[model samples]
Target chain A: MTAESERRTEIMDAVERLLARGGVNAVTMRAVAAEADVSLRLVQYYGSTKDQLLGATLDRLADKSVERWQARTRRQRECASPRDIVESFFDEALPTDRESRGFHRVGVSLEGLAITDPDVAGRAYQKHLKELADHLTGLLQSDDRSAPAARLLAWEVMGLAHGLGTLLMTGQLSEPEARTLITNYLERLGPQLCL
Target chain B: MTAESERRTEIMDAVERLLARGGVNAVTMRAVAAEADVSLRLVQYYGSTKDQLLGATLDRLADKSVERWQARTRRQRECASPRDIVESFFDEALPTDRESRGFHRVGVSLEGLAITDPDVAGRAYQKHLKELADHLTGLLQSDDRSAPAARLLAWEVMGLAHGLGTLLMTGQLSEPEARTLITNYLERLGPQLCL
Candidate 1:
């Protein structure tokens, strides 16, 4: 990568850390500059405005997220059933790890952005969701589940996983409780997909 | 309410409007003061801090939401069937209206807050979820469905509603598409809930 692009990546990483630590509220230009150990002017020079910074950061974050999912599934050579694929999708989407929890926070924060603002960042959120749905639908496609069914199920599972993640983070459901809930959901959905 | 309490309500209402329009970032002290049309000092006097304002607003929002649901049900006594209740819940929860869209924005913003901030506002979010689940469970409790089964179904339905609302707001799902999707979900879930 070019030096400028590398610096940009470094800055975006700082913004993500700030976001993970305290949501969008933590993401001041001052905070990003401090966290990235760059000049305050440098942060502004590259980002120009908060919205621009946020929009670019969101696009990058979405790409990283999709790549992360791809990396996890690409190496696996098993011919998994559609049901199993859906189960795996839940496993990957949930906040079972610290890194994943940060991702979920980024997501909910982006969700807030999408709903409340009609800016570039909002469109990035739509991009993220569409790409995510497309990826999951691809994985779920097979001889058993038709493409439309796969798409619907993908959206359903994504919604379930996102909502469940919020519940888990909020302490509404314990970690074990979330696991049990998702397990039951997969079991219930198993028959429908397998047929 | 006492004069002191009335002032508190005013502050919270102001917070809600700002939040509805701009998420967490918009709920700054200066912004809240401007939105409430009160002095910054008075805003602080009522809420004491940002978290305090956010917490009180969330509590109030949850109360208003539950009251609205109860009023809807009380007026339509004949619509007590599980199908009607579920349908009504989806309609109410979806961000279809201007006000409801704001409510959804507050919810999505708080979701991010609930993750990292253990403040009173975060606690209120947990309270809101518990109370929502309790209210939903109450709606589902009947001979037609066991309590445990009802709660799980309620959770799933709530999750789906939330996910779909985000999709709708982001333009990922159109109104007709949402109606069709909800119809399909209810059709599959209906037999499980009804005798």
Candidate 2:
């Protein structure tokens, strides 16, 4: 990659860290410069405006997240059962690791922003969610459910995962607690998806 | 209220208005002063720190929301079955009105804040959630399900409601669409709760 491209990635990484630690409030140009060990002028030269920086960071997150999910899906060749697909869905959604938790925190931040500010950050959040839903629908479209039905189911699971993640992060629910919750939830779907 | 007290309320009200419209970043003391048509000194006198002001506002929101839900439950009483309770739960969660939407947004903002800030804001969110769960458990804690089971069920419904609210705000789910989704969901629940 070019030097400029590498610097941009570095800046976005700093932004992600700030976002995870303190939401949007933490992502100042100076802070990014400091985090990246770069000069203020360079940060300005890269992003130019706060909105531009936010948009680029959001786009980067979208690209990276989607790519990660796609890469995971590609490693599996057996499209045999919807049961397996949905299990993987839960597995992917859970914040079982450091990277996943950071991603989830970023998601929670954008979601909070989207509620009140529907412009720079809110638009980005919708884009992320839409892409995720599309990816999930792709996974379950050929199952017993139709595309629309599959999409709705995917969204339902997404909603539960988001809520459960908040509960887990807040200590309201432990990891085991969330796992049980999801297990019982999926059990309601039964083995029909396996057919 | 005296003039000074009225001004304080005005300042806090402005903060809430800005918060509802723009999340935490919008609630600067200067912005609150401008929004309230009060002096900066007066705003600062009423709210020396942003965290304190945010805490007060969050506390008020928690009280108001719990009270609102209480009112909803009272109004919906005399309903024949748990089915009605499930339906009302979904309806109450819907961000269908401006007031309800504002409340929901504030709740989401606080929830996100709880992840990292975890000061008064996080405490308020947890307390609010607990009270709501207690209320739900009060409604669902009889007959067959044990107390723990009822509480778990309440969390499930709460998680689903929160997730669905995000979906609705993002324009992914229309009113009718949400209704259909809930209908299918409740049908899946069947008479399990009553037993």
Candidate 3:
């Protein structure tokens, strides 16, 4: 990678770390500079402002999350069915592990920010959801007789996964209970999967 | 209402306003006092701390939200099927109107807080979810042949409502789009509704 791009990634990583530890409130230009071990001027040179920095970070996180899912699918070797894609989506989305838990925290923080500060975080969040929806819908549509409502199904699945992730994170639903809930959901959704 | 209870409601209302406007970070004891037109000492007399104030506010909001749904169902004056209950839930839960939109904002703020400060907001959020799930589950059970997984279904509906509410608020999904998504969802969930 170019030296400039490397520095950018370093700065973004610092932003993510701060965001994961605290919510959106913790991420300021100065704090990110301190976290990244760079000067505030260097951080400013990259982002110009805190919102820009956050927006770029969220955009990068969005792509990385989608790539993570795709990489997993590739490693599995077989052509994954719609059910497999969704099952794996839940498995990946749930905050059962530390990394995913941190990711979910960032997501919730972004979600709240998107509401309160709808210009920067809002656009980034919309892009994130759109990318996920497009990717998932494309996968579901690959089936010859895919449901015409593939996009809606994608949104529904994404919505459920997000909500369930919060429930799991907040201790409202245990890991086992979450598993059963998804199993039951997939069972009911069996017919629509058209597999 | 007694003077004390009325004063307490006033203080909590101030907290909610601050939360709705600026999120959890924006809510502090001093800010609540200023917003409520009361003294800081009076706010302290009511809450003792910011977390306590936020927690009490969340608890009251949770009850009021559940009550809003019950009142709506009662006004309809008919036995609501599982599908109907779920349908009305989406109708009410979606932040299409200003009042509901503000409610959704406060909810998202509390959600972010629950993750960052679990001891206070987390307990309140869990209670909110538990109360909603229990109420919805009981209503579904009244159907006499409710699915064995009524509680699971309740959580699923709540989760979907929340996730979709975010989507709607974020401008990702239009109101009509949300309606259609829920319609498709309820249609697929038809057999299981067992009504």
Evaluate every candidate with DockQ and list the scores: 0.61, 0.61, 0.71
Tens-digit lDDT track for model 1 on B1-195? 998888777888889998888888788999988877889999988878899889989999999998898778777768578888888888889888899989988888887777877778878888988898888888888886778767777777777888888887887877777787777777766666575
Which residue pairs come into collision in candidate 1? Answer: none
Candidate 1: list runs displaced more than 4 Å. Answer: A1-5, A41-46, A75-77, A141-149, B1-9, B38-42, B76-79, B142-147
Error of model 3, residue A98, in angstroms: 1.3
Off by over 4 Å in 2: A74-80, A191-195, B1-11, B39-46
lDDT tens digits, residues A1-195, model 2? 998899888888888888877777778899989988899998899888766787778888878877876676676646636666666666777677877777777777778777777777778889888888888877777646788787777787777777777767766666776777677777776643554
Could you give me the TM-score of model 1 versus the true structure? Answer: 0.88
Candidate 2: give the clashing pairs: none
TM-score of each: 0.88, 0.90, 0.91
Q: Point to the candidate with the largest TM-score.
A: 3
Cα lDDT of model 3 by residue, B63-176, tens digit: 899999999888765766667788888888999997788888888887887886676876888889888888888877745555447878888898889889888888878898
Residue runs of model 3 more than 4 Å from their true location after superposition: A75-78, A142-148, B75-78, B142-148
Worst 10 residues of 3 chain A by lDDT: A140-149
Q: Scoring model 3 with DockQ, what do you get?
A: 0.71
